[model samples]
Target: MSRSPTFVRALGYLALALFLGMAVVLRFVIGPDVSFTPQAEIGRYSDADLVALGAELRETGQAGLYKFILLGVDFVFITVFGLWVMLVHAIRGLGPVRWVGVALACAFMALDYGEDLMLAIRMGLATKGNLDPAVLTNPVSLVHYVTLAKFAVFALCMLSVYFVSRRRA
Candidate 1:
């Protein structure tokens, strides 16, 4: 292989390693257990029930932290992936359909990143327990799934590079 091809492959693998490594760190070290919790509107019940309900409500705050952590992973993964795709294209040609997949992946990753940033800010505010009623009602579930999907997409991109390099095209 040419020096450029070899270099590109090295960078791609490095990026993938960084992406997955960070993901693992987030899942275990960062705060996964603290982040995935439920947040229902429990204030509607009697004030006497507020103690038990309050505890449940607090669990949802962990969900917010969960998303904040995921946002960190998603942002790093997509930004690196965007570069990785362009690198693969330069090193080995791919059809327009494959290019479209890269483009779509970038778009999905971008959305995931933006949503995470927004949630992180809101979560910081929520930590102070000053969050608005409407904000509290908003669940972190959506962001959670989207962030996980972002990682999955990045993994697909990494695997595609190997296939692309091996193919005749």
Candidate 2:
């Protein structure tokens, strides 16, 4: 709230960079040969897709590694995004509505972490060849919905920042 516009802008840029970088790193750690598509962006995949992905990860022997790498990425992701929401609040000149962006960002972080943990558990089970379709159903659905809500709230926050900034300009 007390931050200058220029400082807020700098934080926003840094957050954007970290967010993209972590995403790219996570993708690479998951391996190029793996055919698994991330459900974070596209929502949940079909049961067959999950099975195929689990098989690929299991065969490639990278599921555990992926879990570790994703955990690190998720950490950076949430930190950077939390900064972004703060930057948004500053850029919006610190109002009650501006705090809504902060609230949404917190929600996004919680959901993001939950999704990461769920995926890690799924990967662990899959690597042990103990994962069942029935087990995949609930967590997968919950993660997808959480991801959708996270994105929706994030988009709203971004829009609020944009409109508010434009108005000030």
Candidate 3:
């Protein structure tokens, strides 16, 4: 049976609320209390040094990759948001499938949160009343690759759920 457009839109709103709600709680509420904000938390690396690093990246091979990634993420976020709409409509319509979109969203955001946490940890900021001494090590740079992969996996899971749910719809 098909659902009213209003009901479907309401479901979409609920899904979106769940998505943005976690993001907000993480960013504004939990993040500050447990993050590696260098200027405010670590403060060992001077701002000037960070500025130089940014300049260096802009002039090096890494800049293209970074820019490509940032652009890719912009597209990804849009896709995920669109999926929320699809899932919401499906749920309101009372189709055979349930929990697919929510499941994917949960998994996606889980890794997203995890990667963010790992990056925070890598920054070596003092959390839990302990400061990271090896914050500036070159070895830590490699870890970013793993974090990026986790992020990609999160996106893949989200996309997969969206497509699966969409196909079912």
lDDT of 3 by residue, 114-135 (tens): 5444433433221221334354
Ranking by lDDT: 2, 1, 3
Query: In candidate 3, which residue ranges exceed 4 Å CA deviation?
Result: 1-103, 121-130, 141-146
**TM-score of the candidate numbered 1?**
0.57
Best by TM-score: 2
Off by more than 4 A, model 2: 1-7, 26-31, 46-55, 125-133, 137-140
Sorted by TM-score, highest first, which candidate order results?
Answer: 2, 1, 3
Candidate 1 has its poorest 10 consecutive residues by lDDT at 35-44
Measured with C-alpha atoms, the lDDT of residue 80 in candidate 1 is 68
Please identify model 1 stretches exceeding 4 Å from their true place. 1-4, 32-74, 125-132, 148-152, 155-159
Report how far residue 125 has shifted in candidate 2, in Å: 7.6
Total clashes in model 3, counting residue pairs 3 or more apart in sequence or in different chains: 0
Error of 3 at 66 (Å): 17
Cα error of candidate 3 at position 77, Å = 9.1
- Checking candidate 2 for backbone clashes, the offending pairs are none
For model 1, what is the alpha-carbon lDDT of residue 74? Answer: 52
